[model samples]
Target: MELKPLKGQHHVSAITANAKENYRFYTKVLGMRLVKKTVNQDDTSVYHLFYADERGNPGTDLTFFEIPNAGRTHKGTNSISTTSLRVPSDEALNYWVKRLEAEGVEHDGVSTESGRGSLAFRDFEGQRLMLVSDELNKGVEGGKPWEKSPVPEEYAIRGLGPVHLTVAKRENTEKILTDLMGYRRKGSYSTKIGEKQFDVNILETGEGGTGAEVHIIERPDLPIERPGRGSVHHVAYRVESEEELKKWVELLNELRIPSSGFVERYYFRSLYFREANGILFELATDGPGFEGDEDFDHLGEKLALPPYFENQRDQIEARLKPLETKE
Candidate 1:
């Protein structure tokens, strides 16, 4: 009777205003591999790209939907407020500080809490970032370090740390994540915004800190967010295989939650739905894998498409604006 529909956080997708700059930060600055380059299934003009460890392992992925010239998202509830990535240790954090400083990338100095160290920054679209020290992530098997990236190997981003988001109301969403999704509430913490104080809910993914922490804050003073550039598009959770995926779909259905049925991703099968808070949630299987479409070492060398779009490759590529080389 262990029905943990959420195996772990598979990936988090955000909206990026510029594909090139987004690529630069994720690949050159963050040292994450561009695991997949595909188009948005709904809007073919925009790219749905994924960056992750070399093999694009579930919990390690951070994805984006490139909206060429979209404006910034309004800050409020219903938005992914921050994303944390696990780094090796406190020493490694110094390396990142130096790296980001050298590149003129802006960041807030390291903040320590409960013996944990974190460095905060913002992406081009103003999405907040927190880099943390978590030794358990060192030497994690699949990802490659960008040799030229200023961030050192010892401090390289291991994967997603915990995706922090703000919500309007916590009832329905909390119920889904805790009761139906099986996430255990770790504890609560408070943070201040202006003169207002807000309590944050901490949920443990137990998949390790890489994709382990999920924090949701409720701010009544804040307005709802409109998805655009500078906003998170969706958050995906991992599943062991297709069979487990079916079980998850059944459980979600039993709870009267609507979901997108199983869709094949070449690398994994997926389903999606939105929690009441407005953040899109995706359920992706972990099998078949990045090796299914390309070689182990060259997974993202070229644009990849789902089988349904195979015949339209030429057209798709033609529509895409060329990406600059990253060294």
Candidate 2:
């Protein structure tokens, strides 16, 4: 009867065409701290960047792949269309919208679609992001706030409150999220996009998105998505420890869900797989985090690699460009 293997949302990874722009937007513009800067193990040419709060907490972390030359991503059902972050209040949301607009970032007006207040906008690389007002979690404040941002110090982005994923069918995806992932349908809201009525499902969470919440959208009529430049790379679920992760792997196998072998990611072990509905998901353990190999205050300063890649640090560093481009 217990199908949900994951405790809650661990993190969300997306592809970025420009490392410099992406880094600046997440840290400088959005006021999140650059937790880690490393090379992608799969592709050393691109940089793997993690942004989170000052402490580099689990649910607050958002990872990105920086590929300067990746082609445009094709939108379809397989892709994750939008990632939502929870803020403190509507006043905070309004402040962020104005701040982004003042900086010429461009955003939709304040609106209420699903009993939740939100401000939506697109990132530099066409990634759709929304800031929803959820006052449940009291996120740690204090970071280099973007000078031009309207979001005040007391009411800033807590972390990923709820991530909205678009899937091909409602049944299979819903089963995985609620049954296998341990999420409950808090409620549903509808919005008019073009000529269609988009149904959005909100899942309840105690932690308010720190491995605590997730939302799924049933876009049945949309075509399949092709993974590439602009699409989401993967979504990772959080667990308390390696023991919990191992339990999940065993549970998945018992349920007949195939998975990639366990991979030691230094900070955490990872297991990868695709759900029936067609989205890449990862089971990530939170432990020795970004500070494992580097100092807490000075994360994301230089190229950091796992122990296996230590021997080839030179080659790896040479292959990738610095995320902070000097103007």
Candidate 3:
């Protein structure tokens, strides 16, 4: 069966030790809107919080799964090392440099990465992140910033940009990206990690842009990452609908790739599988989004559950510590 190209990133889910702190940092400090305050569907013991642009658009979401007792991440290879968020312009990145400093967040001030201006930083848990300026971008337009964000709309994060993946065997991941997932080899750029310089390959899919690209850095010297708070859980790419997602499932099955099959995520359907390097990849639909259960004006104010979990709401609520998400 012929398959359609996957759109840019749908969301990048990370691990956070404290949901309360995560909410405060992303919503207050970064000025991202808390679009959904839900729980990890597979494991309802903890919270699954989502932060994004005003409307919780497809390519904008940066979500977290809370693990109260999680330890700090042991950073190494074979990991989704860095996630980039899009800003409107190079000027916006300059604004962020001051804002982050004033807010007491340390960052590597504005510098060019892969021909685009970028600022690198980490959350309290040391979750690697970057703000890439979209001033020179040409494809896959960004989402609107939240009008109510603490940061000015122009400088607010617009959406997710290229996700950086570090692996031991570049060929294994490259084959899956190009031959299996249909991503094209855009180009490569030189980057330095500590004292050593390495070439990072750029891969892009549908309507290529910062939003539709992935940067792969091969590091055979490092060990497999020991995941904990601030570590990325998985990276999901966009699919149009359940119909297209089912087709992907069929394609994966035909090629004998093991996957989670189809998972109804309430907001969207998903199919999960790991590539050759053991990094988790999820293909998620973009429709029936976060607005369905909550009002546009008051998203993430209350604990939201999918219809299937409605019956267990009482038990679930009792298990979770109250998180004040209201503005």
lDDT of 2 by residue, 1-327 (tens): 333345566678998888888888887677777778887888877898887766567677778998787888778775677787767677887788777987778688778745567888877877878887764344222123323333456567666756777887767877776777776776777777788877777775434332355666777677888766656888887777887777777888888888886778887788888887878889888676877788865677778898898998988888876556322
The order of the candidates by lDDT, greatest first, is 3, 1, 2
TM-score of each model, in listed order: 0.91, 0.89, 0.99
What is each predicted model's overall lDDT from 0 to 1? 0.75, 0.72, 0.95
lDDT of 3 by residue, 213-286 (tens): 99999999999999999999999999998999999999899889999999999999999999999999999999
- TM-score (C-alpha) between model 2 and the true structure: 0.89
Residue 140 Cα positional deviation in candidate 3, in Å, after optimal superposition: 0.5
Once fitted onto the true fold, the runs of candidate 2 whose alpha carbons sit more than 4 angstroms away are 1-5, 136-152, 204-211, 325-327
Over 99-139, each residue of candidate 1 has an lDDT whose tens digit, in order, gives 78877878988776324688888876787788877755422
Error of 3 at 143 (Å): 0.7
Alpha carbon lDDT at 314, candidate 3: 96
Between the candidate structures 2 and 3, which one is better when assessed by TM-score?
3
**What lDDT does candidate 3 reach at residue 318?**
95
